[model samples]
Target: MRFTFTCHATDGHARTGVLSTPRGDIRTPAFMPVGTAATVKAMSIDQVKSTGADILLGNTYHLMLRPGGERLARLGGLHHFMGWDKPILTDSGGFQVWSLAGLRKMTEAGVEFRSHIDGSRHMLTPERSIELQADLIGSDIIMQLDECTTFGSSHEEALVSLELSARWGERSKVAFGGTRATQALFGIVQGSVFPDLRKRSADALKSIGFDGYAIGGLAVGEGHQLMCQTLDVTVPELPMDRPRYLMGVGKPIDLVEAVHRGVDMFDCVLPTRAGRHGQAWTWDGPINIRNARFAEDPDPIDPTSTCPASSRPSKAYLHHLFKAEEILGQTLLSWHNLGFYQDLMAAMRAAIAKGQFQDLRARLRQRWGFAPLD
Candidate 1:
């Protein structure tokens, strides 16, 4: 609500800023944990908070289906419904409509598709998406409903999609109106991988205007280099005063790379999803808890990590939990990964503030055994 972004420091294209909202101040470059369906999977609200996350992302598509958005409203919004009082950002359900819907129809108005869950029919127009996020979910940061295109679409296909998305963005702004009341509406730029189309989309969004801007339509199988390259062209076109969010993005390396390219906000399911399968993300690298070499490893996941899962519990015990198929394995690993991600963001923020982001990034790449992406 009433989001304000103040750039505190800048190192190359990377900058550190704070996103002030009604719920709280989100430190950038922040990593928002994905809490689709009102929950962050294996972790409790307190556990999630302990990870140092200032905001979380909710899925508008899933909530609109099961449990229903109206139900959440009656229960006093997503914050009260999920018991997390921090800032919440909800996607406009465009990506899910493209990914999860079965039979679909796309038009100038919006998309009509059958739900992947229970075959229910739904219409997701730009106005409807805004209503769902603002009126029902009460999201602090709301995204506009825009068409998402595949990574390798032809230039013509991408141009049509981007134009339609721009129209939808206009509709979304009209639906949002000027009665934000502490809520922020963001416009998404969708142009697949075409630089000219991305510039056009960005210019259109700037013309329409929004509280923030998001880089969309990548990360759908485009490698990190292209994503970074796209940002190279698109990010400079956006307003410097507004926040920049990169939606549905990726691994630890991906986060650092995007931050280097001037992205301010991010959300992904990688950490929790990987943890559920017995993986742990450490400063050294991601390690598999199920590895036979760790069957008797007595060390914790990361002895220096502030998370209890990494500081108190040993790898041997975590390995035992995984081998035994115990639920604690998922819980512990998820906690560690979430805490690690927050720590990563915090470190980057600090580095940027000190004008040492490049130095910090180089150290991280060396420690994580990743060569620079040239």
Candidate 2:
């Protein structure tokens, strides 16, 4: 597979670029809405496309266990299965394997765990993860296997996981082979919160080589400051010409901060999860529609926002829906939240290309009150 990253412009450490992949071209400073289990929960493919998302993420752990890769292949890959012609990126399921199952066994070969749903046994090695992702969806960007540990983990534990991920990254590359001509494999850099260990992980992955690099194992529990510190040391060591992804990252402020630290792409569940909880992300800050303050408020969530939820639904209506436990309310809110995130990413890319990212980030943080490290 051939992957090209072209840097369009730079503002401080932040830069805007376009990633040309066989599936499609993705504008840098991109936000991939999570479509775990091949669906962006509460929203349809057409609905998600309207949000201006260039790519969507699918979960390997979920799909492999449920409909299964073979079933997806028979169903004509994820694109046909989901009706999303745009690019699809799938996680290696390493993180899900670590987080989902009740018990898991890890070794140099791979991981063995019982399915969270029915306690069925399964093994997910680096080879199998790559095979499943490539042979099934043939995703545009594929993540390598990596151990995701919580923040404040011991340095030794983090280092071991980092080294193992590097090894798995190599295995994934070998398993990917040439048949994945349109697909690209990315390595995940995992080192918990230690800067030195992060560098070590970066160096190891670079030696192995990858289409892109992802800053994994972060945002689990480490606050924004520590995560940025890790990126501060980690990004400079990576090849600037390649895309850098910060996985499972969060709030608007977190996105801005990570961009400032040189992250090119991101994916998070905050927007959708928040929307399901009757919350909305706005220019001023995140506000819960269920809050009593919105009981009588007639204004839209954010009239200036592009997200349909932000302007289409009134605060009072949204509050009523959330209070009444209506599903449409959550669906609309999720759509709006996703739209807001895409809009934010577009704004960030534009601001960086125009050399105004610093000012933009500062203004956002000031207005958002430092983005509570959720």
Candidate 3:
């Protein structure tokens, strides 16, 4: 349960580091593809590993309601269950409950909600959330259960939510005691869009102490600029030596900007989700295979990509597969998208190590047709 972060270099605010865990060492400024139900949709675990992902994100809310946590423990943990020998990080089931909206009841104790799958009842407190993540799911990195506030909430509401989440963080830490040798518990910083409240949340989590820190409550609705602004204020308040994760974030540009603001880890479903809908992300930008122009185009999605989809398949063939509703199209596109994200992360890591992150960032902006926030 020993976790260590070794920072190798820093280019501006962006940093390159390695996170040492029991399963393996994860290169920081890393992207974790979401495997919400213990499986990354449309892709196999080996396929996911082939993309050079050092870690994967599992959803505590989904697994707990599906096969159940105790079932996963009996089956020898999530890693064995999913055939992913690499590290796994599981969210605390808070965000899912928050998203449940009218279906959930929130109080100082915890959240109670009906399962989205079966409409069954369940309660998720901080203690139970830690137990599910560490004891049952056997995740290497576990997150504290925190209330996820909405984007347009009032200042007072955000403050109250942040304080409650800090209290829950204390409970999660106490529950994670002694397991610190093999498991890491991270405290989540939640303050909506208020910078001062974000600072307060960071200070509270630091006093409570955690193996890592996560910037939550962003990317829900606040656009890229506001999200980065929140990170700008919150990141410096956290311990520089611990890994900083930006949860449920973002497109390719979002990853670059977050890293520029000192984020070390990220997980999102953008790549795979977009792939399922006949979309592809390239170094240049995103393209829709469903478009009529692709029906006659012979070029590959990304001529520079080494992935099979981007290297072997023609744009016309991919368009045909999607047009005919063939399953292989989505699978291949998912592979390519994941591969692209991994390559991007690797490039960023190298650029930061070589003190050329800003150069790389500018290059990517130019290629992707994006402009930096002014």
Q: Model 2, 177-242: lDDT tens per residue? A: 866667888999988888899899999999988889998988888788888888889999899889
* The best candidate in terms of lDDT: 3
lDDT by residue (tens digit), candidate 1, 1-374: 46788999999989998999989999999999999989998999999999899999998889998788889889899999989999999999999988863477888888888888788899999999999999999999999998898778899999999999999999999999997869999999989888999999999999999999999998899998899899899999899999999998988988998899899999999999999999999888899999999999989988887888789988999999999999999999999999999999999999999999999899888888888544
**Model 1: residues >4 Å from true position, as ranges?**
372-374
How many clashes (backbone N, Cα, C below 3 Å) per candidate? 3, 0, 4
Point out the higher-scoring one by TM-score: 2 or 3: 3
What TM-score would each prediction reach against the true structure?
0.98, 0.96, 0.98
For residue 152, give model 1's deviation from the true position in Å: 1.5
Candidate 2 clashes between residue pairs 3 or more apart in a chain or in different chains = none
Pairs with steric clashes in candidate 3? 1-181, 1-182, 1-183, 2-181
Where in model 2 is the C-alpha error above 4 Å?
Answer: 371-374
Candidate 3 lDDT score at position 37: 95
